[model samples]
Structure formats: structure tokens, C-alpha cells
Target: MVADGTKRSRIGMGFLVGAALVAQPTAARAFNPFGLFGEDKPAVTANAVAYDLQVQGLDGKSDVLTAVRDVSILYRLRQEPPQTGDELVRRAEADIPRIVDALWGSGHYAARVSIVVGGQVIALDRPASGPVRATVDSLRGRALVPVAVMIEPGPLYRFDRVAVLDQRSDLPFDPAELPPRVVTIAPGDPARTADVLQAAAALSDHFRDRSHPFVKVGRRSPVIDHTARTVDLTLLVDPGARAGIGGIGVSGTKQVDPAVVRSFIYAERGDPYSRRAMADIRRSVARIEAIGGVRVREGTALDANGQLPVEVEVTERPLRVIGGSVRYSTIDGPALKAYWAHRNLFGGAERLRIDGDLFYFTGPQNWPGGSNRRGFNTDDIGGRLSASFLKPALWGTRNDLLVDAFVQRELTELYTSNVVNGTAAIRHRFTDSFNVRAGIEGEIGRSTDVLGRFDYGLLGLPLAASYDTTDKPLDPTRGVRVTASVTPYLGFGDAPDAFVISRIQASTYYALDDAARTILAGRVAFGSILGGSIGAIPASRRFYAGGGGSVRGFEYKSLGPRTLGGIVTGGMSLFEASVEARVKLTDTIGIVPFFDMGQAYAGSVPDGSAPLRYAAGLGLRYYTAVGPIRFDVAVPLARRQGERPYAFYVSIGQAF
Candidate 1:
């Protein structure tokens, strides 16, 4: 009867959580709002109990037979609730049934043999704070957030009687702490579910501290706890102190060594059980070239002696993918780009990507820059290669490496420049919240008919760091990334004019509200050149800030340092800034109304040669099975000191 009861309870609980209320909720996981905020504030209000208590998955239809009621019982462990005020007493009376009903819906209590009542219950809020801290209010000199909260019942009296459940009769650390007061089940006293859970957790953590993280402590609730306020405890145990590899499996594989695949599994023979280590294995698997949605579920088998036989099952996802896009806008005209990438191209090791982007006019439009081809047109074809590795970061940190190369061209120019560039980078993810990346970049080539020179290509090094506490990556509700990098040539090497470039970039995204889920995104980047007949930064690197990456109101490459005649004036550089608000309509698609502002002093792309470009417009994004395809029609909100504000953009990917 007991076993059957537990099974039915689990089934009912699953049915409720899976089939009740809200259909198609937000994505699988939501970034924690309170945690993302600067700091977590107590949920409990000063006089009242709740500051932000979300009654998640609350169902109103199950109250009939389930008779779910939220209840809070008082226990005498620390202190008991007063038999006092009408408000506290009245409120508790009303709230108790509600809480009790809610918990009854909980799987544990759902199938109790007694339909109505059997055990007394107690309800209390467990507030967690600075933990084992050397001092209070200490945020500095910390490697991680040392504070946490947990809810528990029953002061699980420590025990001397504990045995390995697996070994059947194996013994370790005497069973002297066996039975004491409250040794058997008691009525009215809520079962010590929390105590069992906490004990298991504490035991697991104890093993993790030494980095041998592979010890699995298996326990199920009540987990059969017999205890009273004052009683010694006995724990039945399951011991597999050592974990061993059973074998391995593959997902999304072309041709990679099974041994190499096995390496990603941080858990190994004799390793201690560790959730953290398992998580690392998952991340590494996802990062393995050409794979998506990589998920690793781990389990263990027990021998007659209670020893654990480790088993790891793998599920591989797709890596090589091809996709095409079409978008229409006023500024970019009708644009399309085709891309192909192999996450795990040849094997599960390296990354290879190829893209061809073409920009054209919807109609033959006259430009301020006189006879510039029939209409706006440009084409870019590029490929990048990256090899992953871990490197030591400054201050004893470690980071990953990505080395890449690319080549591209200008289709409409009277003078076309074909260029080649290569870059090597090391990025150190210092912690979950912070990281730094540094790299060296170099390029060599011929400009229009500019003579091809390879005198030690100019070196570009970008050093950057970022902090993110947000829950999601691509669709962050709140987060910030800041960067600074410089690439100076020894004067584009003895060119007519010697020019060097330096730039700084900053971007931030914040959610306006959770219920409404509104978002605000902003960006700013400054680029300038120094020295010689060297010439303005190449239209490529000189920095064009107004379009997609900058002020969405502007056109691509259209918004940056430019001169009259819609030509990038021969000298000088520019800085751009923009802010926009985004509203997500669905998981994949959204719309944004934005105001754009920026300018160009030296070089230029079509759209303008003015010192300031102003634009305001609304953009629409359709989230597809593959990714988001975007379209925007922006008109100048106000005429700039020297330019026109009418332009449209259609493209894939976020504006920034």
C-alpha cells in the first residue's frame, strides 16, 4: 500500500504540473530577475512576509476534490507564533488552508493512504544570509557569492547509526548514533523532508570541496526520517565512494576519436560525484564544433556490494547548417545574405564558417555623392577558421583561444581593394560573472590601385572584459559588455598618408518588466585615426557607427565618418552613439522603435557625408526555426547639420 501510494502521488503530481493551466509558457528557463539585479533583497517584507512571492503554477480549478489549501503550521523548534492579534491570527487562519491545499497538490502528500489528514504540519520561512562569513557586509575578497537560502523541516538530530544501503550490510563509521527520541513516525509533526534533502546535499558538497566531485549520494524523501525534537539519528547509506567509466556514446559526430570524446566527460573512474563537473562536461560538449542543443544525462548502476558502476549516455545534435534570408527595408533596399557553417566540420575539433552578403538598392536612387554607380551596391564574401584551446590569463586566470582569417571585396567602387586579414585571440572567462579577452590581429593588401605592400602588417590587439548576470545569452533581459582595442599601422606602411586606428565600444541591455517583458538596448563606439597623408581609416576598419551595430535608425555603412559627395573625406575619424527599446512578441521574434544619432568627419558610405545623422523608425523581426530575420524602415527623425534621414534596412540578426 505504501509503495503504490507513492507511485500514484508522483503520477498525479506530474499530471498537474504538465497539464494544468498555462499552455506554452515562456521559454524553458527564465533568467532570475532578483539575482540579476545588483544584489538580492530579502523576499520577506518588514512587517509582512512577502516582498516578491510568486505563486508559480498556481491552479484555480483543482480545489474541488484535491481541496488544495495553502497552510502554515507553527512548530516550537525556535519560537512559536503568538496566539494574538485578529490580523495575524485571522490572516494565518485564512492562509493556512490555502498553503496546505497548495502543498497537498505537492506530489509527496497527494497519495497519502489517509485521504484527509494524518500528520501535523509546521510552516516557516527560512531566510538565508551571509554564510560562514569572516565578517558582515563583506563583498570584497570574495571568489563567489557566499550567501544562499533553503527551507527545511525538523532539526534532524545528528546520529551514530548509519549504514550503506548498497553494501546491504557493509559498515563504515559505526552505527552508534542509532535511535533516540522521536525514533519512529509521529502524528501531526510534518515529516522531515527538508532534513533528508539537506543532509544529502551537504554530503555531496563535502565531497565536492576537494575537487574529486563524483560521489553520488542517493536518497529519496521522508527519505524515511524517524526523529523528534531531541533524538539521535541513524542514516541508511548507499556508498560508491569511487566512480568509474562504463564507456561512451556520440551525438552529432562526423569523425572524431572516441577517446577524445571521452575526455570532455570530466567525470572519470574513481572521481567523486559533482554536479559542477557534470555541468562542465555539458558545456564542453555543446562547444564541440558543429553541434547544437547538446545535452548529457548521467546515471549510475549499483553492484551487489553497493559500489557504483558509472554510465554516461550521450546525445549529439546537428552542427553543419545552411540557411538563406530575404528582407526589405527603405535604407538597405531589398537585401539578402546566404551563410553556411559547420560546427564540427571535419571532426569534433575545429570550426569553419562561410558567408556571402549582398547589399543593393530597391530602385535607382540618386546620391549626394554624384554618379556613384547606377545604384547603391556592395558585396562581401568571407570565411573564418577558429581553433579552440585554453590559455593562462593575467592574474592567474585561464581563457580559450580562437584564431581566424578572412578576405573580402568592394563591388561598386571605381577603385576596389581586395584585402586579407588574420587574428589570434585568447579569452579568459574569469568567472560566471566576468571575463577578459585579448588578441593580436594583422592585415596586408592592395587598395584600389594602391600598391601591395607587406612590410610587417600593422598589428591589432584588442583587450576586453565583460560582466553578465542575466539568465539568457542571445536574448538577455539585462547585461553589459564593454571593450577597448587598438590597431595602429607603422603608417599603413609608407603610404601617401600614414593613418592608425584606436576604438572603444560599450553596449548594454536591460529588461523593462518581466510581465510585459519590455527591453532596452544601447550601444556606443568611438574610433579615431592618428598621423600622415596616411588617409582616413579604411571604410572597413575606420569605424562606421550609425547602422545596425550603432544607431538602428541609420543605414548599414551609411552612417559613419563621411565627407561631402557621400565620400569618406580623406582624413579624420568619427564616433557614434544610439539607444533603442525592444519589445518581444514571441520567443523568436520582436519589434523595436528606435531613435538614432551619430556622424562621420572623414570617410563615408552612401546615405551621407554629414557631421550628424538622425533617424527614427520601427523594425520587425521574425524568429524562424533557424534564427531571426529582420526588416526596418527608418526615416530621419530630424535633418542633421548636413544629411538626409530617409533610409530603410532589411537584414538578419539583431541591429546591434
Candidate 2:
């Protein structure tokens, strides 16, 4: 029998003694810094006394045995021996119903539990009398107590009948009409409480997603029959009137224009109400750099027009931000990058960002004791500085204006170039997953390669289109992404040429399990430079592969045609493919085993001027709220004469 808490408190000193014993730490327990009664208190103590806890009658039902142990206070605290036999007996008595509840949750409606302490049986019907006190007193001086929790988990109950009823009409839905996926559970299925609750939730979502904003899932009723070992369950659903979109309100605007925010929302007055549309509205609004957070709220009651009104609440991020990052790879050495951005430059959600990257302090071939070792020079350093501006709603809410300019100096094994370039483009979003951009670009540069130094001026028109359905930009668990681009250029000065460059790349992700613990991902890319001779094309414009972002194990730009002097000169065509398996070992940690193959070709197509290179690697990922931190190690399957044995890379986000 449980003691009355009110009576125990009135008997002040007696209650305090029991509370102290339960609160204070002993040799068998450690102090909980969170609080004596904090919800995070450890269920099991490390220093608890040794005790035998036998769970019987579970047969081979390991899952049920695990469930029982999870909820049993006697098992959890067995190591923390109570200060008195009375406390121990009280704990054992409290665990009986909890154990029964656990059994019921697993479809065992008829269950029995028995607990024994020392050599005494604890009767389920024992009263709060002198005999109970005598049992406690008899074990008071015992150094150790043997405890046993015996359970008779009865027959697992299965569903005999399942029904869904509309509360408003007080009519049951036809079982044949209800979708099996939505209802989840059916007759003859195990009547687990979890599955029953999941079905109720799914039914509510099915209606809510179909323009019913006020859908409600009423109480669930279950009828159990111990004799037949079966349960009859029914769920009530209340789907309110269907509604359309009404007035939209915007709030929490500090610096951004409210009209601009509203324009980004996909919903319009009188449009059909849809959960997907609301989600799109949230995503579009949140994409603005000025917005830190966004929330879409639907009114509880329809307006006079019988349509739902929505409120858009937004939180503004800081207007100015300065951030930087560092990355390293055994092949590329070390790199440092930094950026500064003005999110709301002119108050209409215009964005301006300036970025700088410095890389390759020491050339890859100059590493100490290498085959091609050389001393470092200032010319070995490479960097780029760029600035970009974006004006949203340039023509309409779906269009944006982008302008960019950059000055760069690139030093690699294949070439060295210094260039200045600029571009102006208009990007139009046809839908959330699709977009296209067309732009005019101008470049003036001087480059040195195996063909020798030359100065050139070039003007070009560039166009690109992309489609993406991945769940995340940094790390994706599903969906496919494809991008295609074409650029045509006219050259002047020392090298005069006319040429076009076209490329297409596609990648896809698939989750192998429902929980996304395992994933299969693949990528393929191809590019070609048409109409221009190898010597007439700029080294920067030529195709090249082999690096952390390409073949992984090989040096950057080291897998193309070579000059008579054996120096890599890049190529006119490129092809690459990669496949990887991502497996999670724990919630926050994962491992990826990947294979990559590709090569650059000297001709307009892969004419087999050089055989394709192949590499294999393993990666580690530390998942976080923003993205996963990645570390990868790779080795070439077929080692070339001059290549390193292996390479390692460290950075953030997935390799793709």
C-alpha cells in the first residue's frame, strides 16, 4: 500500500527522514548536479550495490524483456541499495504497476508481476499493517538482499476489429474505402499501443493535408477481451470545413520591406488551402538572408469569406556578418577563406557579399623529400577576391538580378594565370526545384602554360539551368539534382579563337532504410570544349580532373594530357563518376565508403588518349545542426609512377 503524501508531510520529522535518505548520495550513489528531483536524474547509479535481478516468464521475447527492464524502478536502482528495508520494499511495490503498463504497451493486456526481497514474498494485496513493518524490520540488518522480479506476460493481443468514425456525422467510415497506408493498423495485426496512436495521427494528417485546417483527432477507445486475447479499437476524427486562402499578414519586419516579404510568399488570396503551399511559403521567406527565422500561422476560425487567414512572423538576422573558415588536404595543402556580407544593403532585401580565398602556401610538388620537390616562392601562392550583389524582385517576385566581379591568381601544376572578370545575370525561379540563369561575362587575363605566356581578352555569353529536389544543400538523404550549362566565347589579342564550352552534371541520393541510417549516392559529370584548339584556349577554360573534389587520390589538375616535357597541360574534354555508401554508426557519427573514376581527355571527346583513373576511400562524418563535419582518406587503386600512396582531406559538409 502507498503512504498518503499529505499525512506523511503533516508528520514533519518522519517525512524528512525518508526524504533525506532518498535525496542524499551514499557510497552506492553519486550526487546529481542538475537537482535532487531533476528529470535528467540517472536511472542507474554507477556505484550501486551488487544485486541479482531475475526477470522470469518472458520466454524468448527479448523485446518485451527490454521494455520491462526499461520501466522497472527496481531494476534501474538495484545498485543504489536503499538505506532501509522499508525504502527497498516501497520501491519494489511502486514498480509493479509500471511493469504491468510496459507489458500492456507491448500488446500483453493480461499480465501478472511478483517481486521478492531477501527470502520474503511481497504480496500484491498486502495491507499497510504491522506485518508489513515486520518484514522490513527483519531485513534491516542484512548486508545484502537478493531481489527477483517475476512476470507472467499473458498471450499477446491482436486486433479483432478496427474502425474509424467521423465524430461530426457520428458515422463510421467504410473500411474498404480507407487507405491501408493511412489507417496503418488492421484486423489480425498486433494491438501495440504505438501503432494504434500512429494510425490516429496519420488519419488526422491525411485530412489536414487535404485543405482541412481544423482537423482534430478525438480520443481513442479500445475494448479488450482477456478470454479471446484480442482487442477492438476505434478512432474518432473531426475534419472541419474545407477552406481557401484569405488575407495574409506580415509582422516582425525591422529593416526589410514588408511588401518584399509578402511577395516571396507563394499563397495568394482565394487560393486553395494546402499544407504544401504553406511549407513553400515558409521556405521561400526563410531563404532571404535578412530573415533569421520564419513562422506561418493559420487562424483557428475561418474569416467572413469562409477562408483561412495566415500570419507570417519573421525574425531578422544581423544586418552585417563577417565569417571565415579553414580547410586542408594532403594534395592541395592548406587554404583560408573569409567573407563579409550586408544582408539588407538597401532595405529591399538586397544582398552584397565580398569574399577572399588564399590557398597553396607551399606547392604540392614542393613538399619535403618528394620526387619533384622544389623550393617555395611567392609565385607559388594563389588567391582570389570577389564581390557579388543580388537584388530580389527585380522584375517580379520570381526574378532576381545578380552582378559579380572578381580578380584571381591561380597557380597549379598545369598552369599559372592572373585574371579579372565580371558578369551580370538575371536568375528566374520557375519553381522551388527549378531555376535558369543567363548572363554576359567579360574577362581579360594573361596566362603561362606549356604553350608559353600570352595575353588575351575574351567576351562570352553564359547560360545555365538547374533542378534540385534534395532535402538539404549541405547534406542530402534523398532526391536528385541536375545542372547543365553552356558558354560561348570570342577571343582577341595574342590568341584569337572562337569556341563553346558545354557541361552537364547530375547526382542522386537514396535512403536505404526508413530511418535514413543508410544511404546510396552517385554522381556523373561530363564536359567538352568545342571549336577551339588546345593551344588557343585559356588554361583556366580547359577541362581537368583529379583532386579532393574530383578523383580524390590524385593531385589537382594532374590527370590530363602532358607536354613533351612531361608537364600536365589539362585537356579539352572531361568525364567523372563517383558512388558512395553512407552508413550511420550513431546518431551523430557516420562513415562513408566511396569509389571515384574519371579522367580528362586531349580531344573533344574521351578518345582514350589516357585511361581513366580510379580511387577508393573512406570518410567520417560528425553530424551537427547546421551540417556534417567531414574527414576523408583516399588511395588510388592503380598507382602511377609519380603519385602519392594516399591522401586525406578535412572540411565541412558532404564531399559532393
Candidate 3:
């Protein structure tokens, strides 16, 4: 019986230690480096009590108050009150050093903290007196214990002097020689612990960027002058031997060939070691669909070749993936899309995907010359089937080959067509943010429009370039994205013509605050068909704007030029611009108010003959792990005759 009881005590202690380690914040952890359990004490069972925790002397110091509250075990676990007054006393005792550290971290180096439990002052310098013990003992059967925390936040410490020195020589660098941004800590600036530590890290990075792979910020010695309320900080840096790239290795590759993984890394042997190179290597390896995660490890010391050795560790994701999405709009009806992909084919990180989509399930069935009333009809349904193949690192580490083919039938207000198209392209990534592609595409289709029925076969060469610096793909808060593309085509069969289509679009985002809770985003786009007349070009090849992705207030493809007989003919030129203010009301929810303007013209360019349509709307976003689920309600600011008063849309991700 004794042995069993001992074992149970040990187990309970182990659980408590684990929980404390996980629950405590960084400041608390630093104060108690060892596990929280000093010795195993038997669990005490007493009636839980309601308690009032009052923190004083921080009336105006909200920052310090918040920090203190965050690290207070009594405040954090208030819902589950301590079973005994002794346990409460222990918790208050444990919080003393943590609270002091929190105060010091916020530049209050001379701060003092005290605690009074149940009207008994717990002196920091001495153990509890007889009367204090008696007061605590009297709370054995009480239902309440009022605790007060008193803090004396002296003066805020400012930087007196800051210096960076060589670890071995103990020689300080001249202040004038160091870069302006390297030593962020300056005299007269608040000597907050975070700023001091950040300055040390910045100094270390400065040397590391200059080819010091093993640079270390060895020690930070701070001397506090209490009388002057200032701190003098000195950072010791050990910039190890300058090194170059040594042996590059890859590990954790299961199905992917190790050699193929190495090909994705752009860093070469004997190249000067750089932090940027390691980041680039990590990104390149992660770009592979099969690679779930990547870790670039650097050797602690230089290798036999006097260069830094790098090891690329990667975790493989599932080989096969299947997913789908659905979207709907008042004007375009509902659409369902599904796809299945093989991330790694033949162990080379090659990807192959097949997709199927059904759209316009219940939408307006307006033939070339018919009424626009919405209705459901089996014959009006449109669907598409497509397949795509990607071969990464085809010619070199920076290039990839892409091949795609699709067959689809469309039923729209302006035209009806069944088309098959195929494209082969080689995309070369110049950098993480920039890429360019040139491809050859061919399309064969037959369509019936307001003009008449026509069969056409077209061949085109398309060249495109994209630059994106957005922080996130689904929803971005900052940076810009620009894309330009031009495709020259030769039409054959029934509709013989030559045309060149050129388009350029740019979007930018600016975060209004550091947290990015509010963002201002804008976009502008322009497109023109230089050669072919509007009537000669295939309806599918022409530009049309409206609906969910374009001007949201209007119907799908309803913003372009119309025929005299009331048939809607697509445009040869297009222009679009939109602005949005995305504001997050909560972590998982956001609201966006947006304005959109654009027009499609019969002429080859936007000649100002046609007026631009305007729309304004408010959108609700439910943020998720993958992206935001979007719901928007929009109305045309300048509603034309016969146009709907408002439109609503539901989809995933941001509108852009």
C-alpha cells in the first residue's frame, strides 16, 4: 500500500510539471528554468473559494499591467480556484519573480512587487509572521479570499550607451563605422529588453550576411545605473570563419529521388554562404507538391573544404489528393468543381491533375435573340473537363514545363460554343516573386452568335510575365502584384483572321496598421485586341466583364457592347478598376466594402465612346485555415434600365 501511494504521487507530480511547462509563458519559464515541481507534496482537497485579485500601482501603465496580468498564475487560473489557502499562498509566492521580470522587460528595472493574501502581508524579505499565519489558517473553511498585488514601478530606464564588441579581442567597433540600422539601440531611447535583444540579433545578422555562416551573439551584458535610470548594453559577437558552400545533402525524402530534390536547390558548391541562399533553398524545395515541409540545416563548423555544409531535410506529403469547391451568384447561378491530383508521379515530383466543372445549373437561358428571364433547364447546363501536367526543374532548377488540355461547352446569353483547347508552356522563375512563360496554344471550336454560326480553328503564341510580392495568396494585406500577357493568333476554317490580344493588370495593397487589421487595396486592368474586328473574332475569344469576378452588380457578360437587335455581343477591348477596404472585426471574421468600375468597348481600345459601369458592395468574410469563405451583396450605383437592383455572391477566397 505504501509503494502504490508513492507511485501515484510521482505520477500526479509528473502531470503537474508537464502542465506548468506548457501553460507558463516565456517570462515565467525563464524565471523557473527547472520544472515547476520542487518536491512532490500530497494533493490537498478543500472547498474551492471565490477570490478577488486586485493589482494596484499600475493605474496608468496599461502595458505593464497587461504584462503582469498575462504572467500571473492566480489571474490565469481564476476560474479553477485553488482548493486550499496554502496553495493560493504558494501561487502568489511563485508569481513574485515572474512579475518582477515582466516589469523589467518593459524597462522598469527598479520596480518592486508585494502581495497581500487574505489581509496578511507576505513580506518579500521575511517569512510569514505568527499573525499572518493565523489569518491564513482562519481561511480553512472560508468561501472567499481577497488578494491584492501592489507594484512600485519606479522610473523607466533609457539607454545610456550601447556597444558591439568582438568576443575574443573585447574591442568595440567605432560607432561611425557601423551601419545606421545595425545597432537599433541608441542613447535616450527606452532600454526595453526586447529592443536590446533585437539589436543584438540585428548585429549578428549583419555579420552573417557578409559570409559569416557561424556568427554568434555570444553574450549581452547590461549594466543598470539605478540613480540615473539608464542601462548600458554591450553585445559580444563571435563572427566565425568566413565560409563558402560546402557539401550539400538531402534527407527525409521517401518517394522523391534525392538527386531530384537536390536539383531544386540553387545554391552551388564553393559559393559564398548567405542567409538569403538558405531561405531560397527552403522555398524551392517546398515548391514541390510532394514536399510537405522543408528544413535547411547548416553545419555548426566549417567542413574539410573550409566551407559551410548544408543539409536539406524534407517531409513528404500524401502522394494523391482530391478536393473540390462550389460557388454561386445571383446572376451566374451555381457552379461545382472537383479535381484529383497526383503530387508525385514516377518519383520526380511531377504533378498531374484532372478536373471537372459544371456551371450555370439554374441561370437565365438567353439565346442570341431571346428573353433574359432566369429558369432551370437541362439543355442550358454547361460543363468542362480538363487535365494539366507539370514537370518541375525540367531544363534547369529555375524552369518548369507545363501542358494543359481542356474541352468545354458553353451556354450563355450572347453565344453558345463547344471548344477544345490545348497549351504547352515553359515557365522560368527568375526569382521567388517573378516568373515569365511562353507557350503555344491551339483551339478548335464552333459557335453560334448574333452574326451567325461559324467554325473556327485558331493557333496562338502566348507570352506572359508575372510579379507578385503579396504576403498571402488567398488574402493579402500588403505588397503588389502585376501581370502582363500578349497572345497573337491566326484564325482559320470558317472565320479567317489575325489578331493580337494584349492585357496588363496591376494590384496593390497597403496595410493601415502594423497588425494589418485594416487594409486598402486597389487594382486596375486594361486589355485590347489589336487586329481582328469584333464580328470576325470568335465569341469566346472576345473580352466581356460582369458578374462575381468582374463588376459584381451586373449579370454575367452583361457589361460589354450589345447588338442593335438586342443581342449581347462581347467586346474587343476591356478596362477594369476596383478598390476595397478590408477590415477585420475579429480573428475569424472580416468585412470589406468595395467599389468597382469597368467597361467593354467594341473598338480595339477603350475609346471613351462607352461609359464605364459602376458598382459598390459590402462583403462578409469568414476566415478559415485554407482561405476565407466570402459572401457579398452588391448593387449598381448607376443602374441602367431593365438591370437588376442588386446582386449577391458566395465563394471562397478574396475577390481578386
Q: Which candidate is the best by TM-score?
A: 3
Off by over 4 Å in 2: 1-103, 112-155, 165-177, 186-189, 269-272, 304-306, 326-329, 364-376, 495-497, 585-593, 607-610, 616-622, 631-639, 644-646
User: Against the unseen true structure, what C-alpha lDDT does each candidate score?
Assistant: 0.44, 0.77, 0.78
For model 3, residues 1-656, the per-residue Cα lDDT tens digits are 01121121221221101111111111111121122221222222256544566676665677777777778887777666666566777788788767877787788766767677777666345345566645665665554566677677677878888777888789976656456668767899987767867776887778777789878885554666656776676778888788999999999998987766876787789988888788878987787888999999999888888999999999999999999999885545789999999999978888999999998644444564233545545666788999999987774467889999999988676777889999999998776778999999999998878878878999999999999988788898889999999999998987657889999999999999878999999999999998867778888878898888888888878888887765568898999999999999999999999999988999999998789999999999999999989999999987978899999888888988
lDDT of 1 by residue, 444-488 (tens): 654531222223235566566666554344455677866665544
Looking at model 2, the pairs that clash are: 48-79, 49-79
TM-score-wise, the better of 2 and 3 is 3
Residue-level lDDT of model 2, residues 72-100, one tens digit each, is 88767765666665777788778776776
Candidate 3: clashing pairs of residues: none
Using alpha carbons, what is the TM-score of model 2? 0.78
**Model 3: ten consecutive residues of lowest lDDT:** 14-23
TM-score of candidate 1 against the unseen true structure: 0.48
Instruction: Give the TM-score of each candidate.
Output: 0.48, 0.78, 0.79
Model 3 local distance difference test score: 0.78
Question: How should the candidates be ordered by lDDT, best one leading?
Answer: 3, 2, 1
Name the lDDT value of residue 167 in candidate 2: 86
Return the lDDT, model 3, position 404. 98
